[model samples]
Target: MATLLHIDSSVFPGETSSSRSVTDAFRKAWGEQHPEGRVIYRDLAADPVPHITATAHLAGLAPASERTPEQSAALAARVELIEELEQADAVLIGAPMYNYSIPSTLKTWLDNVILAGRTSGETPSAQGTPVVVVASRGGSYAPGTPREGFEFVQNYLEAVLKGSLGLEPEFIVPELTMAPRVPAMSELVPLYHASRERAFVEAATKAKDLAERLAV
Candidate 1:
């Protein structure tokens, strides 16, 4: 059976987190479509990955056989993470915008998985592995908005995962997530709920389609 790696980076729990709720929908659809398929879940907010340190950075660059004990220990967790990604047939990520960028916990996981030789280096291409990202933002960042260019989450992820890592990713974004809760955004509540609904629907559809297509 095919395997999927599900990663959630939201700090909030339950329905309070748009990204998590959307990803949960995706997971539900995926499970229904591929009941026998394997799923590996990692909750970065609850259990954050270690940030890449200078030593770990150097360790990843060197040949595994040549690393020292310290380097080997430092690189172990990262190696495991990369192995999980490489082994999976597909990936799903719950990515929420924080301070105009991805969560630091998610960033740390990316740093761990974007390894040379293991994930991207010398591979034919990474595009064959599909990735679905459920991205949610507190405010709207679409074109023509005041914060149009300020949004960096999607662009940065695309650049790293697709441009650099060669993986093909599809993004489902829910904007104005804070509208329902923030008095300043009360006028945008309708749009917020609409966006939220669309995100879950899109995620479920994509998950089912991908599972069917990728399942062996």
Candidate 2:
């Protein structure tokens, strides 16, 4: 059976969070296809990982046997985080845009797992793993949109997951998430629903495809 590492960084837990909802759909479809598969879930909003501190930085630089107690603990956590990714056949991330970027919690998780020799060495690879990102944005940031240049979530994640970690990824983005909730965006409600529907379809399709491709 394959193992999927599912990470959700949405502060909103359920249907309110578009990214979370889309990832749930993906997992639902993936689960149907791989009933015996294992899912390693990490809900960053409920149990947030710590950001890299000076001690943790030193731990990564120091030799394993020569590390201080705090450094050792910090390094051990990093090791566990990296191992989770290393063992996974595929990875799924729910990253909702916050202030035109990914949440701080997601950033913290990235900081924890991005080790020098492990995730980003000269021969770096997320063990040749594949990742699916359900990225939800509150407003439109497409090619001709006024906020196009300000969009950073998908671009930054692609850089880190592909460029830094050497992992292949497919993204499903649902834009204008807040249109239905904001009175000013009333006219965008149709677009919002359409984007959301498309995201779910893409998520399910990609999840099943990745699951089959990565199955052991």
Candidate 3:
């Protein structure tokens, strides 16, 4: 059976979070397609993984036989995360833009899983795995927009997930997510709704498409 590693980092819960909502739609579609598939879920906001520490960093670099007790303990957590990524057939991430970038919890998760010569480098263990990222944002950041250059969530993730980890990444972005809540951005509320609707459709379509590909 196929295994999907699904990670959500939004501070908000349920439909309150644009990223989570879109990811939830994709996951629902995926579950429908893969009734017997396995899903490994992680809610980073509720139980954040440990940030990389000196011992953890060094432990990853050092040979297992050379690691001290402290290093072993710290590295064990990282190894578990890496193993999950390596074993997964697909990956799904809810990466809401936080101050023009990804959440710290998501960054920490990346740090834990991206081990050189293992999950990363010239030949990564999980290389070519398809990853769908829901990169939702509070405001518009598409080309020609004022904040176009400020969009780091997708750009950074593209480099990290595809460039570093060698995963195949495709993004479904829901922009102007704060339009309904922010008084000044009320005019963009319609646009937000359209973007959100499009994202949901894309998520379901992509989920089914990926499931079909995986099954083949």
Judged by TM-score, which candidate is best? 3
For residues 143-166, write the lDDT of model 1, one tens digit per residue.
899999998999999988887677
C-alpha local distance difference test of each model: 0.88, 0.89, 0.95
Ranking by TM-score: 3, 2, 1
Query: Ranking by lDDT, best first?
Result: 3, 2, 1
Lowest lDDT 10-residue stretch of candidate 2: 207-216
lDDT of 2 at 215: 61
**TM-score between candidate 1 and the true structure:** 0.95
lDDT of 3 at 91: 98
Residue-pair clash count for candidate 3: 0
For residue 47, give model 1's deviation from the true position in Å. Answer: 0.4
Q: TM-score, each model?
A: 0.95, 0.97, 0.99
lDDT of 3 by residue, 79-150 (tens): 899989988999999999999899999999999998887888889999999999999999999999998999
Which regions of candidate 2 are displaced past 4 Å? none
Candidate 2: residue pairs that collide? none
RMSD of each: 1.5, 1.2, 0.7
> Candidate 2 at residue 156, lDDT?
97
